[model samples]
Target: MGEHPRRRADAQRNRDRLVAAASAVIAEAGPEASLEEVARRAGVGSATLHRHFSSRAELLEAVLHDRVRTLCALADELLTAPGAGTALVTWLRAVVAHAATTRGLGPALTGYASDPRFSPHTMIREAARQLLARAHREGSVAPNATVDDVLRLANGISLAVDSLADATECADALITLVTDGLLRRPANG
Candidate 1:
């Protein structure tokens, strides 16, 4: 027989808490953060955490999947925004922010790049592609700009400023510089 609905809901809630706690702990304590700490943060026991995610890799994958889903959703919402160029810039900034927070998990995520079920790389690429296409169509961005270019630039900026005393400000400044360069110039200018 199937599991009881309330029990299933409770299980799902526990899973959500674990993922959230893991994300927070990892963001603050790096990828090496303890699973026990994650359980503590979630207000659940270690056993519950294990029941939901058998291993660290599985937990990290879940966190990455959740984050990527969020980014993709943001891209979709921004696609219909009033200004294509602005939307692209906004989306890129968000991507950079997420990258900064998840930097510690970079190595772990790389291993899952080949695993179709857990990989967020493709979704991220497609989101960038859609945003870039819209900006190009609107004539707000350089004709030659590619998704790879934007992603590389954002990732670079994120990594470069991650350790600065004013990292947020620095990132914004760098993004502005890049966005200005990306803008389409008038033929007569």
Candidate 2:
């Protein structure tokens, strides 16, 4: 027999809470944040958290998936905004901020990056490509910058200074440097 509708709804609610709580706890306490605390923050018990996520790795994967979905959605929204170059920079900064929260999942995320089921990898790349193309046509970005270049630079900046005491400021500085580099410049005056 199939599960009851109320039971299924409850299960879904629990799962949603766990995922949201995990993201918040991990962001505040890093990847090693306790699952028990996540449950507590979600107003559930540890058993409930485990019922939703079989393991810590599973929870991490869910959080990563959620982040990717959010990033891709933001990219789509930004594409329609005015100023291609400004939109791209805004998207890149958001990516960096997302990366900051997932810093502890570095190796696991790397593994997921190779998996075809992770659509965020493809979606992000396509978004970057379109943004870069628009910026190039508008004469805002340098002619030679590729999607890969921008992704790498942004990812590198996010990872490199994420451990610093003033990580936010450091990230802002690095992003500015990258933006300046990507921007087109005129011939000598």
Candidate 3:
């Protein structure tokens, strides 16, 4: 019994290491980074990598899922922040930053768009939706602003800068454009 539990723990550790390695390799070389590199980085054999992740997509999913969870948690926490619009803007910027820094992330994460139960795409949308809803209630942003709009904007920014040198910094500035629609003010001054 103890041996079985130990094996399970070891397997879990291997999975964690694989995920971590995949994340780093992907971030460095883009989504098309070699699987062999991942296994080597993880200090695991190719067979072990295959055992943990059948395909590159699955491994990417795990990485994106891990990051998405943290992003969602941040969105939830920001709900109580003083400025709803600013909080939403802040979260969106972070989302864009993640996308820009993590090359190929947009496509990798969007691959699960149809998964009803647990999709990184769905998770991010729902998180943004929550923040957008609060912004709507507070009349802090444009009434027509949707989570789709924000996400699309983020994706576009990510793509535009994917080949650029200072992509992350570029993404940070470009994300501010999204606030134009979300935080627009009346001209009744």
Ranking by lDDT: 1, 3, 2
Question: Please, what is the whole-model Cα lDDT of each candidate in the order they appear?
Answer: 0.87, 0.83, 0.83
What C-alpha lDDT, on a 0 to 100 scale, does residue 39 get in candidate 1? 99
> Taking the tens digit of each residue's C-alpha lDDT, what string does model 1 give over 1-189?
999999999999999999999988887777879999999999999999999988888898888888889999999999999999999999998888787677468687556533466557789999999999999999999999999999999989988988765666788888988877776778994
Winning model by lDDT: 1
Task: Give me the overall lDDT of model 1.
Answer: 0.87
lDDT (tens digit, per residue) of candidate 3 on 89-186: 89988887787757876566565543356677778989999999999999998899888987887788888887888888888877766555456677
Per-residue lDDT for 136 in model 2?
Answer: 88
lDDT per residue as tens, model 2, 56-110: 7788888888888888888888878899899889888888888777767756545
When summed lDDT is taken over every stretch of 10 residues in candidate 1, the lowest stretch is 110-119
The model with the greater lDDT, 1 or 2, is: 1
Where does model 2 exceed 4 Å of error?
Answer: 108-116, 180-189
Query: Which candidate number maximizes TM-score?
Result: 1
What candidate 1 gets wrong by more than 4 Å, as runs, is: 109-115, 165-169, 181-189
Q: TM-score for model 2?
A: 0.84
Question: Backbone clashes per model, in order?
Answer: 0, 0, 1
